[model samples]
Target: MPIRSEWKLAREGWTLDTTTRLLKATAFNPLITLPLILAAKYTARGAQVASQNETLFRTLKSLVALGVLGSISGFLDDKVVNNWKGDEWDWKKEVVVVTGGSDGIGKSIVLLLAEKGIKVAVLDVQPLTYEAPPSVQFFQCDLGSKEAIEATAASVRSSLGDPTVLINNAGVARGKSILDSTEKDIRLTFNVNALSHYFLAHQFLPSMIQRNHGMVVTVASLAAYLSAPNMVDYASSKAAALTFHEGLAAELATQYKADKVRTIIMCQGYTRTALFEGFAGKSLYPETVAEEIVKAVLKGRSAHLVVPESSWGIVPRVRSWPLWMQYGFRKGLKNLMKSWKGRQVVQPSETQVEKEKKGVEESAVLVEEH
Candidate 1:
């Protein structure tokens, strides 16, 4: 049998961040330097020693210095630069609302939070793939519909109290070029991926402002920075989402005077999920991405997280390059997606059938009232 793409990448250490971490641990570790220093000292005392002893001693000293410098730099980067700290709000009091929690990275996040004993409410059109504990509640919601989101928010508030954390994770990607995309496809993509964030924030942010404590997490993609051929709608929506996150964060600090209300925007690379099944190139595991988001939230800081960390500088500075260079870069990216075979349609589970039935009944009642 052929090896799976995710497994093959993991085994070969294709992820740049993972490879860099391993190299640091083995090659730049101070523990490794200590042994080398001792070996050099012992070898120098032998009769066979020549200029090799001097060279070894100098190399060991340089390695030790590098190791110590790296340690200090890491400490300062985490503490002084990032300013990461423990959670400020009580975990018991935190009620989390995660949109699109039925599958993919959203599902991973919901599970992780539930495992930590936090109250989690999932707002998704689909049903849960796995059984969840009492801490997790599912609210069937079509995020593309503003009316559906408003109704779902009321139900969530009634059931779980005011949500202290809002994760706008719902998104749709129609793998179609501008000319190939239908009007409905474009609208649905934008509504679900971008406009839903606006609606959700409007519903939940005022309460967070009043309390002066909350966390809003936006899960975007690297496509926000680089557009490809078949992902025009997807990339545009992500760019909108990224901009919305930045604007919201700025408003929280400057206008609302609520800096404690943390905002996190995650621009992740392609993730290993059913959504991107036949997409080529290196991709991150959903679990790894979820864990990073959870860690950032718990640390109580506002940040823009870029997966691989290597893209942190490059993605933001692409526009600064010459127009020809920019064109070349985008062309290269477009060529990569020429072979994409993303999951065209997803089958709804039995739980989804039940949820759809319930949603129809509730929607009828809501429609009657209007």
Candidate 2:
């Protein structure tokens, strides 16, 4: 599907970054350049043209050289530079735990892993809205509470064994400025979005180190790098989450000598989810982010994955630029949230509540029959 116009405009406004991405997708694309070179050479030969052929030869040479350089660079990045040697993960033996797996990107990840026959334990405050396959088990737990997380972790270990992959995906956003945010709102945001990661890692990392095998996936936001109005708390928590992941990864390698235990940090853009309902911006689909998460796990690599890959270059360099340039960049991004109407809180209908009650009764009867 085509991206919304508003999102396109926001990205286009980041002139240098957008232009670089365009060149990479076109001029540096081997498939397009290789075909063009072949066509040019063929035309030169068929026309019996000598003078015009000079341009064709030069173009062909440049394309070939670019292709070779690109290939070499990719080889070095994949084989030599990256220290993550891929490991074979047997799905049957692995237990996957995803926080906030009842909805949005977390839900997508839960469904995907469950469908692959991997045992998945979902820890969330809400019950699963959809019927999950047998392989997926739902554990009701409020992530913001450290005590709840610890108790739930014990339950998970008793039922499904220690989790091999831990995905800290739960998050909350108040979408209020620092002054407007109440104390509870700020605490909830930080506890759920940032502190939960530390709690879960402390609970689970020891076992992973004992086995010297595991993967930790942290789902942060692009807000970590760039902030705008009414997102102060949300962005700050995400930044903390990013830092937590970095410290955990380093500690695993240096303190514990468990370098094989992989860590992946995903900084995703605004996604099409209920959590960000009224926020107007270019948003990626939940499934797309889920797919990237799965791919990273399968590769068993420690790397940062940014959605809209264009931000890969821009985000890291933003803080190092001149103060005026940094302020300008942030000012452009603030426009994205100007049309934002925050998500409305909806209470469940009476009919829906009755249906849930009936479902619980039916389950009770089935257990009695068994």
Candidate 2, superposed: residue stretches over 4 Å from native: 1-84, 339-370
TM-score, per-candidate, Cα-based:
0.76, 0.78
What is the C-alpha lDDT profile of model 1 across 1-370, one tens digit per residue? 1213332345325567666667577667888876766665577553244244677567667878898798988677545322343337788889999998878889889988888788999998777878977899999887878888899999999998999999998777757679977666678788888999999998999999888889899999988988878888899999999999988877886799776688889999888876676676678888777877887777767767888676776876888899999989888876556656554222122224435655422221112111
Candidate 1 Cα errors over 4 Å, as ranges: 1-14, 22-87, 344-370
Cα shift from native, residue 95, model 1 (Å): 0.6
Whole-model alpha-carbon lDDT for candidate 1: 0.76
Q: TM-score of the candidate numbered 1?
A: 0.76
Looking at model 1, residue 200 earns an lDDT score of: 96
Global lDDT scores for all candidate models:
0.76, 0.76
